[model samples]
Target: MTKDTMSIDTSAELLENDILPMIREVHTDPDVPCASQGDMPKALAEPVAKKSPAQWAYERIIMYIQNFEKQLDNDHEVGMGLAGGNTGVIRIEGLGYYDPDIVTYYGTSEAGAKTQLIQHVSQLNVTLIASPKHIDQPEPKRIGFRLAAGLERSEDVTT
Candidate 1:
């Protein structure tokens, strides 16, 4: 099958053989494959980022469509959403995200930045998710081994 049609469900394995060796990060060996999307950090998402808040809000609503598709592919009895992967609405004033089942963000501000996001994850029964992106700083936590361990348990995860 062409790479395009190759199933990503087994991406965990493809990651081990095809993608890991060339990586520069010492901790990024085959055992822990990074983002399924690849080095998204190197690829600028600014054009997509420039979209207005309204646009972001709209696009996010359907981010979980594929996950739903997977659930449909199953017999429909058992679904996974209570552990490390789950999606829910995150409301921050004029912002909203129907986040994918694997993203977690926390902020620390007058609005309870660090605490609020931590509380949200705790309530959801999720213990880990992908790291948030920031244009200004390099978050070592998002790099490799750290990411795998940083948010292992959602209850205590915070910036």
Candidate 2:
């Protein structure tokens, strides 16, 4: 099966434009369903607290980035199921040139992953493992990115 890939900018503008609408739908439409609390163990799923839409969006984005980082660090398959039977694998890292070891550790190479750290804004590439049964949909929630190491260090220094 062929994977359809998309490069997305995870900047505030893009998030507001591409992602927020779908998120609004998920939260407001009772039929659409919020993220499944059922899949989680009872201990984890119980005591679900309500949050504002902005907080929910922020939390969801943070969770996606953190999960992606864990998958990269552990060398696990970094895939998430999207709507309509399509699955996607996400890769994100710091901006700028990285040593070969860093690239290798992150399971991406200069040719593949080192294209940009934070060119216009934070960016990510999503490779969708799609089949004929899968229909494409806007899934901004699936994409994530993190600050580049260099950028983080610089900010730390300035602070």
Candidate 3:
């Protein structure tokens, strides 16, 4: 078989033999729902041989953020609390990964000023918080979907 065919076969085998089984075994809090098989993006199902650690971390984080957002009410949006130091919370507006080992966040602070944080994959620690939506906004922003869509678009462009 050609190299591309071989790679496709390997990926299908891996998904059936490894990824699907593991996903089935995943457990979560009774009150908090997790991503179902259908909810997972296709990019996540297909394994990439040379994916960087940063890219892997970024994808997993996006999955988590998406799941968490599903548990929020319309009045609340996702915010991230940084660990260590006196760094405060930020409303997560955007996310990006730098190849090799870096993840970056762009958002607004508690005071509503623009903020950005960059961290190495090793030191990455994020606590998702439910912050109240702005008074003028009719509903909380569901960033998880947007972020996941962006990730898929980036994958499409790269491929």
Candidate 2 vs candidate 3: the lDDT winner is 3
lDDT of 1 by residue, 1-159 (tens): 986786555767754553332323333456543333333321122234344433332223222222222223122211122334333322221112233222333333333333233323224442222222334534322222222232333332222
* lDDT of each residue in 1-159, candidate 3, tens digit only: 666664445766866654542444356656557665345676676555547778777877888888889889999999999999776999999888888899999999999899999999999999999999899999899988877775566355122
Badly placed stretches (over 4 Å) of model 2 are: 1-61, 68-73, 77-91, 95-113, 117-159
Which pairs clash inside model 1? 107-113, 107-114, 108-113, 108-114, 127-154
Q: Compare the candidates by lDDT and give the number of the best one.
A: 3
lDDT of each: 0.30, 0.30, 0.79
Deviating ranges (above 4 Å) for candidate 1: 1-49, 74-159
What would the per-residue lDDT of candidate 2 be over residues 1-159, giving only the tens digit for each residue?
336876666677654554333322234645533333213222222112333333232334433344444333222323322233322332332222222111111222323443222211122233322122112433322232342121223222112
Top model by TM-score, which number?
3
Candidate 1 overall Cα lDDT vs. reference?
0.30
Q: How many pairs in model 2 have backbone atoms within 3 A of each other, for residues 3 or more apart or on separate chains, i.e. clashes?
A: 2
What's the C-alpha lDDT at position 98 in model 2?
Answer: 26
User: Candidate order by lDDT, highest to lowest?
Assistant: 3, 1, 2
